[model samples]
Target: MIALLGCGVVLLSACGSMPVTGDIKAVDASQPGDSQVQVYAVAPRENATPDEVVDGFLESMTSDDPGFRTTRKYLTKEASRTWKPSAFTTVLSKAPNRSQRPVRDSDRSSTELTFTLTGDKVATVDAQNAYQPVAPTAFSRSLHLVRQNGSKEWRIDFVPDGLLLGQSDFKRLYRSVNKYYFATGPAADQSTLVADPVYVRNRTDPITGMDTVTQTVRSLVEGPTNWLRPVVDSRFPTGTVLRKGVTALAPDDRNVLKVPLNKKADGVGQRSCRMMASQVLYTVRDLTSARVEQVELQRSDGSSLCVLGSGQAEEFAPDGSSGAPDSQYFVDDEGHVQRIPGSNKGSGDPEPVAGPLGDGPVRMSTVGVARDEQLAAAVSQDSASLYVASVVSAGELPRPAVTSRAKKPEDRLSAPSWDGRGDLWVADRNPDDRRLLRLAGGTGEPSNVRVPDLGGARIEALRLSADGVRIALLLTEDGHTTLKIGRIERQGDPDTLQDVSVVELRKAAPQLADVTAMSWSGRSRLVVVGKEQGGVQQVRYVQVDGSAPASGVLPGANQVSSVAAADDEQLPLMADTEDDGIVKLSPGDNWQTVLKKGSSLVYPG
Candidate 1:
């Protein structure tokens, strides 16, 4: 791989209006002894024993499965495509017993393949057949092991099921290997080896009344090559409309998004990623009455439990104790508010995390919504509290993951959204790692999918586009703003991240400051920004081909703080400011509000 170092000049390229690199460093591997699933490179000794690394990896795959969750980060395009056939599960399933695992056969050979590298032109592979003796079965097939980058780091993948029958391709791949390449038919097709679908929703078009639900989208992840590419299966109905629509009685929109969180037993819940299971998440309703009415519980079963938000305004005294604002959070099936206790905190407003936030730092954040029912919010800083709702870290975790992501306290939670069964996407930043984060997976222990890292800049505001594809983060460093845009998932090599781009606000909206919040008008090709300076709100857009400047800069938005837009083409920017009340920036550059105290607005579920 040393020969490829010259390619650094060819490879490429965050949001926070005034973006900065967080300096999230990779963990120091040399620090005496440390623990983390990571890749290491040691100087080759005079006669270092063969490709021991590959042998070790095969062993680790069975014994220590840590690499399963983060392998995509290091995969090349070809390898990632072959191994991660689908985008979601490349990081979704890690447990040996999950349905995604290959079914163990009684006659299968040992589940092991060791690689030995002797020099530039020669290498050897030893296989431990997986089929067991009881079911003794032997199969032969053609396989290829290709090197990625310049390293002897080889990947063994099948070349389409039976195409190998043609000797030409086989000769092209294995003609140089020792003897004839060792053969073992297909292990389970990786596609069938996915962790079963987590969340699914069944929605019907409101006007047409046609079903919009489709079969389950196994895990929120699929293979990197198949990203954003919809998969249609006959098992469930298939159709999509402008929106993800409401709950129904079918498998597509199975209706209940159950998330499995990423957890480690630290006595109290410490910082980690949260896996939002199958569920569709929606934003909070725009508030009209400013009188702080009450918080209530909305369950997946469609039941409502009123919360007495009065006396319990800011306390964390359990469910029925001290009448705290405990009900304002998300609740699990056991009726317990799933919280991490001491992990919540807020930015610049240090009132000691009053109430349910307790004494946590109050930088609590959220991911998306849960199956259209609850908002995912991290209620603590030291640990994560599900609040039945919402939504960081570093070598603190790994690379790609560290981008956009700041350190623990800074991984301030973002709202979480459940795709249906249990797929969740949480927003976080690690300035230290220069990466943004998307914490994906179940509630037990989440898989951290790193995005292009955004450093030093503080993410004053962020929001996922209603279309569910785009995400906007308003970044600020020393209170200055900059905007960064990139794909939602982290795929490919841990050292090689794809699709992370930054748009300088000064080049777009030069007058904006402390760009606190942002959201995508998904379809209209626009990004809505809420500027803190004089509450100046602006709507800007970039073309897939990179044309035109951010065109829709309104002259009067002195009070808007939050926004949400689905009909991005008709109305691009929605501003909720103290002075502007509610302003809608649309086709005619209009301005108006449908409600007040619009701290948040949504197309309610």
Candidate 2:
């Protein structure tokens, strides 16, 4: 559950617009039924006091305006011109302490309104439309307010860049929306479209729906929202635009979307064209909840260039196949990797994987496997080295794939992660060498992946999503651990990662103060262990959006050492508990020990 730093009051009107003094009512098609609409918030009154203006401005920032036009009203003309709300958005977990004090050595009328910002820095959205995580810290923003000559009204003359909002308001104002991008896979079959999750305003313009279907397409055409931009490409050209502007997108009567492109798609090949259509189809489906069956890409002349069926879109979606492996793999008492058979009903003795890594004398403290279950990466018992070897019998000793450069033995390396591209990811926890590294598959050299500014936090654990686009990291700072997500940006087929190409980190579970272990439970959900400060260790499931289901902690589990779940949400959950070795939990069922003596557990892919 999200921790509330301070109390918050709702400032916006109801979700729907209602008639004022008569029987007539306004039908708001764009109003969100599940959430409130802040687009209709009241603006600051004319000639308001400096404090009121600042408070109103903060409240107005929660409105659903596209360019923050309503929010700029509180600013002076010159200040508004210089202000760029898109530059950044600072989300606070609670309201800040506000005060206005006279600026010294300046005009007596010059007043500086200071906002003592406190509480969790939940998330930050950058000018590039990418959102990243920020650790909880107390910060301040000073707004200089002065009276305008002509109007004699006090407006903010100078202020910090970006908009600020409390956590409660942030939840009601923004929502997670996914844009589909094609993942590089077998060329013969262009399957596997990954979901690049992004947050968009929840409400849209009532008449045009710009915040709905149109926003999804526009964001997609703008390209991947994060580091995925380097690896993923869109078939849409440089200047692709929806016909009739961004607001002109809607499904047709037969559930077919007639997407009129500004540029002609005649040059795109058949396979690429279909892939383009699939991208649009999947993106639109996410908004319309599969109300759209197909997407027909059309030329400016209205001729159909290509059509993508909904069936085709499903063939390569994130959940395209049977999902991640059902069988759970873990390290046994002797440090050998063992597998528990059956999907959710596995019982009896555990079997070792068909490789030397599972049965050899090499003592592995932690392990990770590739998506295809073809290979496994293991960390030595001392956590000073990493080894990657084939899961199938190779008749060779597991070779050292990665060794930490740290001087201390305990801070050497983290458990390794394998992405869909077959690249392995790990973080060096050494305080002096706090860095993330990606190793090319099959004994390739390791390249340092840049980590975003973590506010002096050191990464303790790193888990890569199966899609290879996003990564989960457990960062420890000041004795507190945080869970964050970052995007992986790769330079175009480079032998080594360029300094400019690095994973941009963001907040995925900003509410959780201590997260020891986590695993991707589904495409967007993570099964995490650890709890709020001073709370008992229990397994809780969390979404990539920083929200958790009401299912609460896993039943019959305690002091979970590690947790593992498949990409398929329906599969049973596996975790290594303090007392129980390896336990499995089917939905709505209590935990049952599957392996009597296991340590760490994972599911291939």
Candidate 3:
């Protein structure tokens, strides 16, 4: 074991006689680049008090110690040997407040020190490294300390099972990364990749001694998380893993990443091997500063299995778009569906679409464009019926594909949404006839979608992910609206919908008391408009797993009634505000007025 005296003495001698008078300065602890700050741990000193020992142990949890060697010195021999730091992590809003007291033994011969730790819990990271955020709640834990019969040094006999950290420390140490897997039921010619986001140590991982890039590759081979396992599949075979002693990965001069695999993956076929390589390329594309243009997989004996280029990987993009969208569509003041240029920098003149919905008898209140941009579904001005029409040429509007009989317009129908698979979704909010409906290919007969776990809540609005594997729902119960995400499960052919359902509804933004509008911003994230209890409305981005991203809050908008975003994040974010009409927010810029009067805005799904 490493001696604790070396670190303890150095720290004491450096600050033994320093002056303690200076002007106080304030610093922003939540800056974006704080992750680059390194933390060093100091071991306990000789003859330390009980409070000092407890404080030192808690501070060491935030340090960059390798395997937490110095942290174990503050614990008794038995506790040190049995402690497991990798079990889970509990994150508080700030450093926990500690208070100490004395506890008498049953025989009244000896006394032990008990310290209570209290804070507001913010989130928790499970053993699988999945993050789940919750509403702030009170937290309390206790630690017990005892000294040997003849020793003056105090050591902790009881400690928490896993690590505990504050919000700032947790942000500095961990980073979020997305791993890619193929959607379960897509055909071989139409395989689509889905993202599974998780957290890993920003620098070297203490448990595996692997860097961030290598850690991400290893996680992809391990398969998707439990909640997503029912709707996705991994091409990596069972028992596959990285070669022994491989601890780092980087792109070569030609921007190619070579991955070495164990014997379990040695027998994969050429096609399957390329698919495996695509998964690696997509997973690591955003991790490194230098772009990775290709990926080459190597076998156990140092022979190349197969190679996949970046262009080939685009064949399986989630949205299936050629590139970024060229235009964004919305309903203008005259109830016509008009479109403007999709560039983020400046605004352009808006023009009507090519179909009857753009200039017809039925006035449209909202619209949903197909992923291919060839067709659109529009809800009537009164929200009582939904119509579909071709947008590429002049044509007559089709009859209403869905209709509602609710007396009140607000309780009739919601804005329609199109998924990557060409299916349309909407909800009828009538109290007497509430149902979630889906139309196959936006032209088939509407069918009721079974939501087994919705309890008694009514759907107010809905959005489908670009990959067609997930859905976001705004649910209202007792006059309170909340955001929830559910997995989309289909039980038939890819081209046709036979049996469809949305199951396993989980809260996506538990911190917010009311959700008004939302749009899918990226593969695993959503831009939401909501407010906390007794707080003002705010716009922010949250992951599908419910964790808020670092620097996710956008510039404030007033009374945003609806919002729209493209799968490609480079496009501008559009929203309709009651006070500012229709506004667009681009990257690194403030909100700008796009139109003085508009109700709903949307991009191709």
Candidate 4:
């Protein structure tokens, strides 16, 4: 039996004279900590009233009862047989408010009671456990109850198929985990893995009776979410699934996890099997407390298919095996691109990058380093010209790869960004000829990438994800700036350049009234510098899906103009501030000044 916390029954009178007897307890819907305190539902008491039955069911939805069996006790037999909690989840800003009303029969007698649950909807978790945040809107759902034929007890006969939870309860019961998938497309490398983030129960999943690890692996085998499916692939063979009746999975004493798959994966080649094992190793690395040093794939007949160690899995790492970046780059007081060792110990004197962009005639105001750190794309001081050159060897400054004809400096080009595919992206802010352009291999002719849903908004800044499949854009319109994440779709052969466009744009930070800067901080997260309505500027980490994490907000800084973060979390976060020049915030430390006169700081994309 599970222990119940902060539960108490409240009794009241019905018509100012008759007594109402039932057990209706208020749920303590507070957010749980990292330890993940568990909550379980209570069975309904005898002779419960209609309101009591509805309240009991709603509270039970927030608990960890196995199969939600206790919750079904408050429902009619027909409803219990038909309800599907795994269909989806509706997340509200707070616990839903309930109001009761009576349903009349043809004879004008009260035959049933309907309780309406209403709140501010914040997000929705689809059947695949994919989270999608939406602008907050009003939500209302009705549950109808009736008296049983044999007993006077009230039971719910009509209820929604999915669970309704408050944001706080959702955070307490679920966690966001990234499942790995191989990148696909003309420019994508077959060996590189991309992150596909989804939500899963933090502890044991009630609906499936599976532990966290098993649930995550199940989600992985089910493939990527709808939004990301077009750009990624899974090595797991079609119709692959966990062995029948397997609910719990644990790493062995040697920290090796063995996964038993159905026959569909039994005939895969050695290379494909190893790649599949790597995907599992990467996906479960962060989900469990115990270290998973290796993963072994097993056939349906219990024979070994292949094994992959953690070190071997690094070959398919999204950011490559270069480890953390060596240095951070920025423009110095002299308008020349410079770099400093990207270490947390202490700051070092800035040095010029090896080529023309560092010492040439053209003064650069902003810079973007390629993922490999071998090349850099710099925008001229006036923001009209974008030049690309090698950062490892000295050479003459290459001609402008892209140039904007916008008359005003502020209306010219935004900062350039390089994706993991070695391609370059930048937005021209020219009002008469606004276009989002991409350079094939950072050298080919600039091509205008179509943005079908941009409407009339202007792009203030743009950052591409390391996987090259998602692009973050700070769109400004009517004096308001918002952050949006767009999906990058490419067409054509792998070797030759082709058409590229950004589509299916979604808001990444809807709560902020104005966004000044942002950078990709993790696989599916961003460090955003923005301000909410009637609020001061703040630094927070927001998931690509728009939902804020538990530890999202960072320590505050003043007058921040720009911010940068490396894919590796250990590297300190750097920012350019008007009051403090360049500053960095290391893990477990407050912001410290790195330099007193540097700007446009950034780590390799």
Estimated TM-score for each candidate? 0.31, 0.74, 0.92, 0.94
Error of 1 at 38 (Å): 59
Runs in model 4 with CA error above 4 Å? 1-27, 30-35, 104-109, 321-324, 343-346
In terms of TM-score, which candidate is strongest? 4
* Winner by TM-score between candidate 3 and candidate 1: 3
lDDT of 4 by residue, 387-459 (tens): 9999889999988998899999999999999888888888999999999998888887898899999998999
- 1-605: candidate 1 lDDT, tens digit per residue: 11112221100000002114332232211121111122322222222222432322222222111223322223335654565322211110111110112224534212322222221111111111000011111222222333434555444433222111111111111111000000111111111111111211122211223232211121221211121222111111122111233323131132232211111111211111111111111110011112322333222333432223334332321111132111112222222222212122100111211223222223333323332323333333232333332221101111121123234655544444332223344544444433333333223333444333554455545544322333455666775765543333322432322232222221222334444455444331334454536764554443211112223454556645555443223433455567645445545645655334223332110
lDDT of 2 at 194: 73
* Candidate number of the best lDDT: 4
Sequence-dependent TM-score of model 2:
0.74
Q: Model 4: which residue pairs collide? A: none
Residues 225-262 of candidate 2 have per-residue lDDT tens digits of 55566556677777776766647577778889887777
Error in Å for residue 129 of model 2? 3.1
lDDT of 2: 0.69
lDDT digits (tens) for residues 339-425 of candidate 3: 776653328888899989889888899999888888888999999999999887998878899999999999999999988778889
**Which window of 10 residues has the lowest lDDT sum in candidate 1?**
175-184
Evaluation by lDDT, superior candidate among 1 and 4: 4
Candidate 2 — worst ten consecutive residues by lDDT sum? 1-10
